[model samples]
Target: MTTITTNPFPVNHPLTFHRVAQPSPPTPFNSANSKHNTHPLTAYTYSTKHAEPKLSATSHEDQPLLFLLRQRKTEEAWLTYSQSTRLPGSTCLSRLVCQLSYQNTKEGFTRAQTIIQRLRDERQLHRLDANSLGLLAVSAVKAGHTLYATSIIKSMLRSGYLPHVKAWSAVVSRLAASGDDGPTEALRLFNSVIRRVRRVADPAIAADARPDTAAYNAVLNACANLGNTGKFLQLFDEMPEFDVKPDVLTYNIMIKLCARADRKDLLVFVLDRILDEGIDPCMTTFHSLLAAYVGFGDLETAEKMVQAMREGRRDLCRILKDSNWENSENADEVFVKLLPRSKISSDHDPPLLPKEYAPDSRIYTTLMKGYMKEGRVSDVVQMLEAMRHQRDSTSHPDHVTYTTVVSTLVKAGSMDRARQVLAEMARVGVPANRITYNILLKGYCQQLQLEKAKELVREMADDASIEPDVVSYNILIDGCILIDDSAGALAYFNEMRTRGIAPSKVSYTTLMKAFALTGQPKLAHKVFDEMLKDPRVKVDLVAWNMLVEGYSRLGLVEEAKKIIQNMKENDFYPDVATYGSLANGIALARKPGEALLLWNEVKERCGQKKVEDSSSSAPPLKPDEGLLDTLADICVRAAFFKKALEIVACMEENGIPPNKTKFTKIYVEMHSRMFTSKHASKARQDRRMERKRAAEAFKFWLGLPNSYYGSEWRLEPDDGDDYSTDSF
Candidate 1:
């Protein structure tokens, strides 16, 4: 018998087992024990051949949280950390934060916020290093929590931690894209962050946090959007200080700024500057240039620019220089200084564009919009056809191009053609978005085609699968007003809310307009009140004017005056529309005294300038023909000839000719026999003479013969003895 002294099985083998051989009997095991005793008689022997229970690889406490995170088991990982007594490592926590933020869901963001709050409470926020904080911030921005991302970066800055350029740039870009005061906030945030970076002691951290080209572009874009030309120039100049060279996008943003500032002369110079800087222009540069020209109502210039692109002529600077741009001489001095020196002073100059730019769908669409603006419907249609025939797919008409065609047709009162275009869109497989449908709906509403508008709305939902948004309901409400159906307007407004679509400012204002048009002033007031209560909508000037119109239409002059007072209190001055409505109200109420007062205020607001003097500066209040006419009508009806003459003079000064024919007709019908009585007392004659002189002057201005000797008159005795005058 061989006695194996050492254990035959490996200690760490899975199947290894240890057991003591049962001592059968002292006499039976004597020889075996004696043989094993030579190697120091073993108390136990191990064997791998026998089956044994498997041991766990690791304990629960030893499990890695990051492993769960890698499996995307975020919730489980978090739960495990919460249940454990020891906190996870900093790397694990940072990964958890980043993963939660990247989920991009509302719940995900909320949970991320909760995690941050827990860290702050535990004084463990420092565990998340600067790099991890930056990732979290960028992730938050991607998840649509821009403000939250901004807060995160701000917290980092406050804690003497500098964020990466990507983190702050993303936030700035998002803020610049928002409406209202978002651009201003973006500028403020950029200034603060940049200040912090400049003050950093460590060169490495400063370099990482320093605003790069993208960061500068973002803040410059914000400045452009705000129309702060001075701020834009300041920031643009600062780019060189930061050692950041301006790219093509920087010039693109500069073009937009010039457009907003109405400095068309600077546009070409900007292109020249781009070329001088050795930067290639992008497609957006061309589109922005065309759009700028179109916005200025300079379709001639816009068309020329597009033609230059089509003909592969890059001498845009030379072309624009030779052409007569209206606002060229009036360019802002500061802006002009920033542009590169113009080389196209003489007609012969090199092309600014380095390469031939082919007109794409967007470029074509921009030119089409210019044609649409000028009411060149045929040109717009021809352009659309031209786009369809283009071999290059980039130049082919897309949905926006088609939508422009539809808008042009609608504006031309060609609803039939517009609807046909919609069909063509479907046939061509270019799906019409809500904007296209809304344009059609607005056209129908403007034409008072309520039934057609309603049908179109249903078609949008049932066929196009495009739900009618708030704009659709707003259009429907205005259409209802056109058909004198205030109840219909209210129903549509309610339906919009019931469908969970929030009411926009247009919706509220439009519904208020419905009530105002139907002579329901009180109901209009209620609508206005509801609008004030709606946080989603702000009461704009149009809404206030509608309220004023509601009251004034019913001859509620006092109430209208009160509303105007409220309008002033709300920082909304009385515009021409407001005064026009009030004037109509005054006419209805027959309050000539109020007319005189309103004229005084209007004259002051208009600066009482003559048409010849209007070239110097724009009047604070541009005179409206309708408002002046309404005021003049009131004065003539009340036989206030002096006040009527004043209003007519103001009209002529504003270049709105007085309605001499209407005034002549009024005089013949109402005041032909005025002051023709004889035998009046001295005092009474003196009192009547002033009005008589004013009437004669007005008749003279109207090119009418003097009433004193123009025609034969029969006199009768006056009934009232106070004046003792004969009536004619």
Candidate 2:
């Protein structure tokens, strides 16, 4: 007998077997060996070499890590991973990183960064392949870590790894949509990708890394949003060089750029360019055109454009073209002539939209908003009804359209009708979102219906499943201010924070206004300090103005001035509202010299040749009638006639006609009897004479008779002797 030596299992293992060879030739069962053969040990033999036992890929070493990750026990999972003798497989490690990134928490992002850094330190970053890094970038973006996502993409590029288009494109798109230097960063990332493509030696890698049409669209959108017309043109010109073509979306973005730049004259030419490029116009194309017209407050042209769409007119461009550009005799001809030939073509061709674009709900709502802007309440309501009657489902009024109707009604003080519209929204099975509820809240608050506003808040939570956001709270706070309920404003402010709704800049400012209006300047200051400490809310000029108003309302002129000085040191120039509040404070405090100083500062700011002039370091201030009148009233009360005359002249220059009748009343009530008493000294007589001459000049401007005086008798010089104070 022979024994087989090969065995797949190790020695001493449970599955290990030791067996003698079977009989070489056929043999009958014998009783002597039957006992040994009873166990039926079948011998298995290998033809070549011994084979190793096959185990599951994820069953053994990665099981613990996978289990912890699956249970979301990331901390425990990392601990197990760190104590491991060897690193996990690339797929396992990549999954760990992805799971960490997907957590979307600060700790999760920090942990993910730590893992990547560990890999780099250990020279094991190669475990994470291109796909893995690309996924990480996308995950970071979803977590709101856009800058971190951008860094991940840059790392991929540096490693000669071409990330998926979705990864980099998403990063660029998110960055562009973000505020501040986001758009600039988006452009820089796009350029980096482009440069990376150029440096790649392999055609396959270059093609993979090359910015696609979507990437170009994203960066172009950034350019448009940044209002970089020159850069927009430059990037657009570069598209064709990279074998990328502008699609309908590209033209739509260009239309937005035109609107933002206020080059309304170029809007039609953009549509012409779209048709020229043979790109079929989408609904967004028409919407952009209509929105551009509406935003520029050219409702007449906007209505005409909408009418053209309703009539299915093919000559949309002709119907909506700027007449100022067509008429060569127009005064703006020189301005139009200076536009770039590419952006605005002088050729008056018959530019027509190739296809008809029927107006949708958005288009109708945009038109309604324009009507709302002009306070044309009836027109906005008619537009809403028109949307409802349309046969197309796309034209049916949705939540936004209904909201516009509500807004129009609210603006017209038709609160009862606005409430009915909300009911209509529910009847039509259209869900009113938080914005719709907030609008109603604001209207109720403005109307001083605090009870109704509070009821609406409850209804939002119970019936609509809509919780009050910061705006809702802000409106309620402002309503409290309107009703002089500072306590109620404080209650709403505190409730919003308790409900996990962080206070915004508007919220803080509105609350401050409540305290300020109620003569609680100290409380307003407390709120201002809290706003400064809040990292989520940015303290803007409005907030600063609110702080000043708070102190000014209490006649705290010194405190208000200190706040204004701080406002300036922070690079925020006092606007009309700021100065107006300060003027009120000065008037309340009865400080004439402070009013004089304020007038001087205001004149300096208002005296600039142009508000947009580059040489001016501070924004030009255009004093409103309220501010001017307040200062003038203060001057008249203090008998500063010369300063008051200068203020009135400024008012006339700015097209704000001075209230001569009101100023005359103030002069008669306060300063009419001034200099009537006899002066003892020659110097006092000369000073009084100087005041009398200035008062007479002011009187001349007011069209008052030279002989007019208050109830007291007039003081006249006797026979051209100026020093004589003779009462007539």
Candidate 3:
């Protein structure tokens, strides 16, 4: 076996100890002497090479050294027996005392062992060894006393037993999990254990027992949490040395670690490895994959994964059914179709199964969540039907699951399905949550049913006494703004404050979008300033994008510029969208210098090497003929002649040609931004011009003449055109 060295005492945890002396030597045992061989001949041996015990360099060696290596503080225990003048109990009693003492007070580890010796005579315990040491270690580690845990582990080995990978694993796992301390030492301990387990070759027990591989797997899981992917990968390759088989847990751990590290290549690689290893990955494995795809909003991949899950669920159902059908009386465990036979035919009340399989509650709830992710309204109804069909073994369906399905359907634009989910929840006598009411209210708002949304909001507090969260208020305010009811939006906003529910980032974002859409910069800025009091809300890229799009739509370039400064001050740097917003907003506002500064900063942050040139902005000169062309298009539609003329002159001075569609569009739009009266009655004028013949064709290919209509709308094509790059 490899020479052991590391001390187990946790010096880092403030109350933990520091050893001042070398641990006492192990009790001497003459393993080679014929008369001294007191153990059953059937006791596990290191080698079967010789008829008599021929010292195995690995599992067993000279008894004194093995004893010494495993020894903890037995010298104190041995002395306490002599000093007390009372009979020390049997070895069994001694160990029981040690266990109880360690469990109660870890600060007195030496005293605990002394009590064990004083009580030893009654228990009559045998000498401890590897197998027992590993089991005791599992308990000790669980209790969070590392020193006592390590001592007992070594104590077993001191009685002429070498620790197997199990004890080593127990100690390593405990040390790693006690996170206030570092992981490096625990990892080092694991490596030494692996080497020691390897060097000690078992004749047959190693094959059936599988101490090395199982221990290695547990350590791998611990290692995966540390973000040390390189070391983890290396360990993966080295796992075969001890003939340990890789299991599903091993692959799952590696897959999750890769996802956390953002190593997509390795994640897919390990996924394939899971298939090759012939281990079926669990839901947890798929959850990690699903979350990873969703994190960056990789919509295509997320959709594909959802599709795969839907298809695979059918296969899983077939497999589960097949497994159940295959089970016979001779089978070690009866694998029913996830339900026991008694439950199927029970006229009387039956024993309830686990929460996961219990009808009408947790199980159906989980299935509903899966359906919502896949946008499977049909499947959701089927699962709810299944829940209703099955008699609930114990508790009834709770409101949490009922409302979750409702909210999901509402968000997916399936108002009928949302109402159906809510109705089923009510039929089951499940209480409606604030979430359920909020979801339906938001849905009504989305459908432009503002009065109904307002009525529900009032009912929530007055009739139901359910306090609404920020989402409930935001949705109503948004709906009000959508229907040109700014007064309603403002009233809802005030009510949100009065209710003592702090507005979230979503609340601020929704209000800002409403203001930007209505060209109310001052109101939007007021809400944004209020949001600053809450640190939870950060000015993210989407927030800046909204401002850019909003200001651009209204031709308020100065307002957009101020928003950019605020975004940067909050430490939110510009992305590709930031540049697009600036370029579009500045062109509308007729500010080339401001747009140029934004474009330059975008280049610097993204590095010109990575980001390709976007056609939205021109280098050196900010607002070019193309920009004027865009502005003129907006002007012609809005019927703002003065803004159109200003744009044309700006392009002309910059030596750029004003395009035909843009100029004609702008001239027509000048008639619109002032349609109601000869004054700046812009709304009616722009609406009439927008319906014109020639203006329609030019704006179709690009977004609107002003604001970006879609998220990530680009003038240039994206490089991720090949869907295959992500799938494999």
Candidate 4:
């Protein structure tokens, strides 16, 4: 047996504590100390600092009362006892632990944290024993206060008190699992603990300080959360050096990381190593691998992996039976009783076999999600059927199962089939959720069937009792806009507001777009103004772009420019669409010079201009194909042939293909100018003579002797016709 070292602080330390000095507030200084002061200056200095309160010795009579309160496990009464008897800090700390222990409610947890902070502020934190602090740490983890938990552990460790393994694991795991700033903080704490453990000279102290597998796994989790694949792999390799062998969770974390990094080779290598080392792969292990294969489009391998999982489930049942768990109907029924709710839906529902199985609904749901990703409707259908038919598996279809199926079908453009799946869900006692209904609504709207979408919304309210949320109305408005039903969109928008459902940013943007396309530019502006006035709605670039596009479409060049300037004033740079819209508007209005200026500004903004261009100092914007095409068309219309050709070259340099029709139009126009030029007359006459000779030759070949060979084929004397200016 491993003998634990003696604790520096006993679990039942005396409540007596010496009061520490608390810093006082700053005092107001007087001018009397200044050497430059005039002759007779009397000044008084008021010091806010007060003397430290003396410590009170422990009362022997109060100890019995504190013990009685602790014995009865009455935390509230302990609080009253501490106040009445002036018990030691140890009693206060014990009361705090008790408060945190029974804190199952959210409000109770909040009160516990408040008490912990209050004790720290009062300089009573030193009275906490290692065990009491450990309990506090665990409570912090349970309450999701990872930072508080880490702070508690760090304070105890700094005081040379080593926390138990469970405490360390709880704090580390909470920090690692937190997806926010927790991962970064978790790494910092892990490093601190590791360094402290390494610095300790005593072997016994070091043993208590050294992190175990759980602590290491927490760090691994942090690395995984941050997607630091390189760091994760490095630490994974170093686990053996730390005398912490990889457990099932270690492999599971590695597999998940590998899946995210798309390191298929590494994932396979780890799984194979697990098998070689006789480490049984848990459900998470297989789930991670299966998700990876499905994500990478290796559906065949994923299907086989699912089959292997099923076999593993059967093997688990056999092992359990051989272990005498299945000796009688009621022998050791823990396994069957502890089956996940996902496996067996209701309490009254019986397990499929004499015992529970491992390949429950989650595995099937995971596979269904993979199929959804691959868009394999047929395979998803087959899997659903397999779940329904599996005799020994109580984990047949659930709500998640039906929802995944419905969403997949909707994405595949199968609305009718999706509705049928929803009906099937209802038949299987799995009611359709908001997500399921929303998917169907989106499907209908995507097909431009707004009437069907409206009917679906009505059905949701009338039959399903699910209110049409902001998202539902947003989709409906967008659907109306798709088929140019502006009035319909507005009606829905008004109805949404009347129904007390606030329009989201998407709602406003979609409505703006609808108004813009219908030539209601002013209405679009009104919509934007309303969004700005509403405190809940913060207008984004998409909203501004839609309004700008509306004005530009109506040849409101100045209005569009003002919108861009306003956007700049708001610290938002104009994107390619904004710049392109303005440029096209200016060009169409026949302001070539202004259009060229706008294009140069656009090039500078998009980082397309040479460094020599004066306006290249602004932050870069992303240039899209539409912007380039607009500039090229503007140049073509302006008859800046040389500049037009330069624009084409710029387009080629930027890998933006020139618009063929627009380029050909410019090319023909350039040649027309050349045809009318004095130097090209001789070349043009030669081309005309070549065509005439070829026509005569073709006539001779056809044996039409009465053609150009006769006197009727006289060349009309250079009489200027419509082609005179164009001809040589």
TM-score of each: 0.75, 0.74, 0.42, 0.54
- The C-alpha stretches of model 1 lying farther than 4 A from their native spots are 1-101, 105-212, 215-228, 297-304, 311-316, 319-331, 608-619, 676-681, 687-689, 705-728
What does candidate 3's lDDT look like per residue over 1-728, in tens digits?
11112223223311111111111222111124433323211123344563432222323222332243335434444344345453422232233333333333433343444443333333323322233234445545654556556655444333323454445566776765555333555676666544434444553433322346556666666666676666666676677765667787776776666566654433444444455456666656555555554543444554454444544342322222222222234321211211233123213222211112112254346546656776876766666555555454432346766676786778688888777776676676776888789879978998998877777777777866887788888888889888977777878888887877667677787887788678776777676677665543545567676777677677677777777777767766555455555567666566544544554454344333345774333233244444445545555444343344555555566577767564544433332222123332467456545433233333332234422332322233334331111000
List candidate 3 stretches off by more than 4 Å.
1-376, 391-401, 404-417, 462-465, 544-553, 591-607, 610-728
Tens digits of per-residue lDDT for model 1, 568-603: 878788889999999999998878889989998888
Residue-wise C-alpha lDDT for candidate 2, range 491-593, written one tens digit per residue: 9999998887778888998898888888888888899999988755568888899889989988899999999999989988999999999999998988889
Q: Which candidate leads in lDDT?
A: 1
Report the alpha-carbon TM-score of model 1 versus the true structure: 0.75
- Cα lDDT over the full model 1: 0.76
What ranges in model 2 sit over 4 Å off?
1-95, 100-231, 238-244, 297-300, 322-325, 328-347, 374-386, 610-616, 687-692, 705-728
**Residue 379 lDDT (model 4):** 82
Candidate 4 per-residue C-alpha lDDT over 88-205 given as tens digits, one digit per residue, 9 for 90 to 100: 5554445445445444455555555555555555646555445556666777678655666776677666555556556766788888876546777887877776766666555454
Regions more than 4 Å wrong, model 4: 1-266, 269-281, 310-376, 392-395, 485-508, 519-544, 557-623, 641-643, 650-656, 669-671, 674-728
- Candidate with the larger lDDT of 3 and 4: 4
Best-first order by lDDT: 1, 2, 4, 3
